[model samples]
Target: MSGQRKNPQARDRTIGAQLKALRQEQTTLNLEAAARAIGWSTATLSRIENGKRHITSEDVAMVLTTYGVPMAQREELIESARTGVQAGWWSRPLPGVLPDVGTLASYEASARAITDWSFSFIPGLLQTERYAAGLMSEDGAEPLEVTMRWRARLQRQRVLPTIDYTAFLHESALQQPFGGVDALREQLSHLVQASTRGLGVRIVRGRVPHRLLLHPWLLLDFPDAPPVLNVELNGSSVFLHDDEVRSYDNMRSMLDGMALSSAESRSMIGQLRERL
Candidate 1:
C-alpha cells in the first residue's frame, strides 16, 4: 500500500473543494500554475482538488497561503480541516453496512442545505427508531447491526437543526408502515411536528407522476463547495458531483412545484395518523 487513502472521506473532499474554490476565485493562475506554486504535480493537485485523494490540514494551509488568502480566513478553514479529520462514531466499521454510510453522514454534517427525495420509504433522517429498525430488520441485517445502524442514523439527524433541511416524500411513503401500525402512527405524528422543529416535510401526493421520482436521493449543498448527490442503494451509495448532479437539482425544483405546502402536509399526516 502507498499509505494513501482512496475514495476520499467527506472531510478530505470538503477541504479539497474549499481549496479548489479559493484557487478559482482568489487567483488567476490555472491548475498547473497553481500546482507549480505549491510544488505539486498538476495531476496530484487535480486529484486533491476534485476530492479523489486525501488531504491534510497542513496541505490546506499551504494551498491557501499560496493563494494569498488572509490569515484570518485561512485560520477557520485550517481549523475545519483539523476537526474534520478526527474520527467520529461513523468511522467504525459495521458488518453489513458499507463505508459510504459513514461518508454520507459526513457529507450531511458539513452541508449547509439538505434536501431528501424519497419514494419507496421514509427518508432515514426523519425515521423513528422503531420505524428505522423495522426497515433494517426487513433488509435482513443482524439485530446488532440494526442497533448500530440506527444509532449512527440518529447521530446524523443531529445535523438537521443546524442546516436548511427538507424532505419531499411520496404519498406512497406515508402508506408504508415499516414498523407496524402503531409505530407508523408515531412516525406520522413526528412528521407533523417536524416543521416546528425546523424541518420541512412536504408530501408529494402519489397521484402526481414524474420520471425523477423513481428512486430516493439526498442532495447536500455546501457553503464553499459544490453540491453532492447521494443515492443510497442496498448496502452501498453512489455520490455524484459536478454535471452529474444536474438532474437531481431539477428534480428538487420539480418537487417544489408539485409537493403540498408544509401546512397541507402536516394536515395530511395528521389525518393519516388519526385513521391509524
Candidate 2:
C-alpha cells in the first residue's frame, strides 16, 4: 500500500479518517479546540475533517503533535499525507470552473459507476460541445469560460470507458433547444450513438407528476470508498456522503423503475428529433 495509489475519493477518505481519528482519540480535543491549539481556524479544520482540502505531511505532523498522538500513529498519518492526495487535473490554474465543479470532476474520475438523474438540461458528461457552451453561456458565464468548461466536460466524457454510466434524462430535457434546434438534434443523435457503446442512456419518458427531489443529482460510487451524491445547485454544489446519500439511492431505484430501456430510449430520442 506504500507505493500503490488509490483513487482520489478513496485517498481523501482515508486521509480524512486518519486525521479525524487522531483528533478524536488523542484526548477529547474537539474540532474547535484542536484548531486553536494548531493555530488554524475551525473552518479549515472542518475542511480537513471532511476531506475537502488536501493536507501536507508537515500539516499532518503539526496537528498530530498538538493532539499528543503517539509516535507510531503520527508516522502512519504522515505517510498517508505524503501520498494520499491525488492531483486534480481540472483544478489546474482554475479558469472556467467553479471550485465545487472541480471536486465533481475528481470524483467522476475515480467512480466505478455513475447513476445520474437530471430533471433539467442534459447531464454534463453526456453533453455535446455546442450544447454545453449554449447552456453555460445562457447561465451568463463568459465566452472563453464557456469554452474552458466545455472542453473540461469533454475530457470528463473521455473517462466514460472506465466506469458504468447510467444517465436518466427526463423527457423534457430532450425538448430543450439548448443550442437551437440544430445543436439539440446533434446532441440527441450523439446520445443515440453513445447508448450503443456501453453508455446506458435511458429515458424517463414523461413529466414527473410528483417531485420529491426537484433538482438534478448523481450518485458516484467509488470502487473502494462508499457512494456519494453530487447535487448541483444554482451557483454551487454539495456532496452528500454516507447515509445522506441513501435518498438519492432510493430516487435512483424509483427512476430506474420508471425508465425506458436503452433501445427504447434511443428510439424515443429519434422520435423526438423527427418532430424537430
Candidate 3:
C-alpha cells in the first residue's frame, strides 16, 4: 500500500512549475542556456521544470543564482524547496483503500473550493460516520480498516467550514435508503445542518436523458493553480487537468443551470426527512 501511495510530490510539482515560470519571465535565456549555466544536463533541468523529479535546496540556489533571481523574490522559492521535502498527513496507510486516496487528500489540502457531483450516492465529505461505516461494510473491509478509513474521511470533513464546498446531488440519491431508513434519515438531517454552516447541498431535479448527464466528477479549484477534475472509474481515479478540464466546465455549467435553488434544496431535504 505504501509503495502505491503518492509521496509529497504535489508540492514539488507546484514549486517546479513556479520555477519554470520564473525562469521564463525573469530571464531571457531558454532551458538550454540555463542548464549550461547551472552545470546540469538539459534533461535534468527539463525533469525539474516538468516536476518529474525533485530538486534540492542547493539546486534551487544554483538556479536562482544562474537566473539572477532578485533577493526579494527568492524567499518563497527557498521555502517551497525546504517544505516540499516534508511528508503530509495524506501519507497515512490504509489496509484496503487505494493509495490514490492519499492523492485526493493532497489535492483537498490545497484546494480553495470543491464542487462534487454525485449521481448514485452521497459525497464522502458530507457523510455521517454511521452512514460511511454502513456504506463501507459491504466492501468486505476489516473492522479496523473501516475505522481507519472513516477516521481519515471525518478528518477531511473538517475542511468544509474553511473552504467553499458545493455539492450537486442527484434527487434520486438523496431519496435512497442507504444504511437503511433510519440511517438515511440521519444522513439527510446531517446534510441540512451542514448547509447551515458552509456546505452547499443542491439537488439536481430534472430527469435528463441518460445520454445527457456525464459521469460523476469532483472538481477541485485552487487559488494559485489550475482546476482539477477527478472521475472515478471502477474504484480507481482519473485526474483531468489543464485544457482537459474545459469539457467538465461545460458539464458543470449545464448542471448549474438546472440545479435547484439552495432554499428550495434545503426545503426539499427537510421534506424528505419529515417523510422519514
lDDT of each: 0.84, 0.79, 0.77
**For model 1, what is the alpha-carbon lDDT of residue 259?**
96
Error of 3 at 251 (Å): 1.6
Q: Which numbered prediction scores highest in TM-score against the true structure? A: 1
Candidate 3, 68-116: lDDT as tens digits: 9998678778877777655566656566666667677777877899998
Instruction: For model 2, state the Cα shift of residue 73 in Å.
Output: 7.6
For 107-191, candidate 2 gives per-residue lDDT tens digits of: 7887899988887789998999888888888888898898878777777787799899999998888889887899999989889
Q: What is the C-alpha RMSD of each candidate to the true structure, in Å?
A: 3.3, 5.0, 3.9
Candidate 1 lDDT over 1-276, as tens digits, reads 134463566787777877888989989989999999999899999988877677877878888889999999999999987787756766665665567887888778778999999987899999999999988889888888998888788888888889999999988899888879988998888898887676899988756566755568999998867788988777777888888999889889999999999988888989999998
Better of 1 and 3 by TM-score: 1
Model 1 misplaced regions, further than 4 Å:
1-7, 21-44, 58-80, 92-97, 208-210
Clash count of each predicted structure: 0, 0, 0
Off by over 4 Å in 2: 1-10, 20-47, 63-80, 84-86
The Cα error of candidate 3 at residue 10, in Å, is: 4.5
Per-model TM-score, in order, reads 0.84, 0.80, 0.82
Better of 2 and 3 by lDDT: 2
Candidate 3, residue 131: Cα displacement in angstroms equals: 1.4
Candidate 3: what lDDT?
0.77
In model 1, pairs of residues that clash are none
Estimate the lDDT of model 1.
Answer: 0.84
Clashes of 2: 0
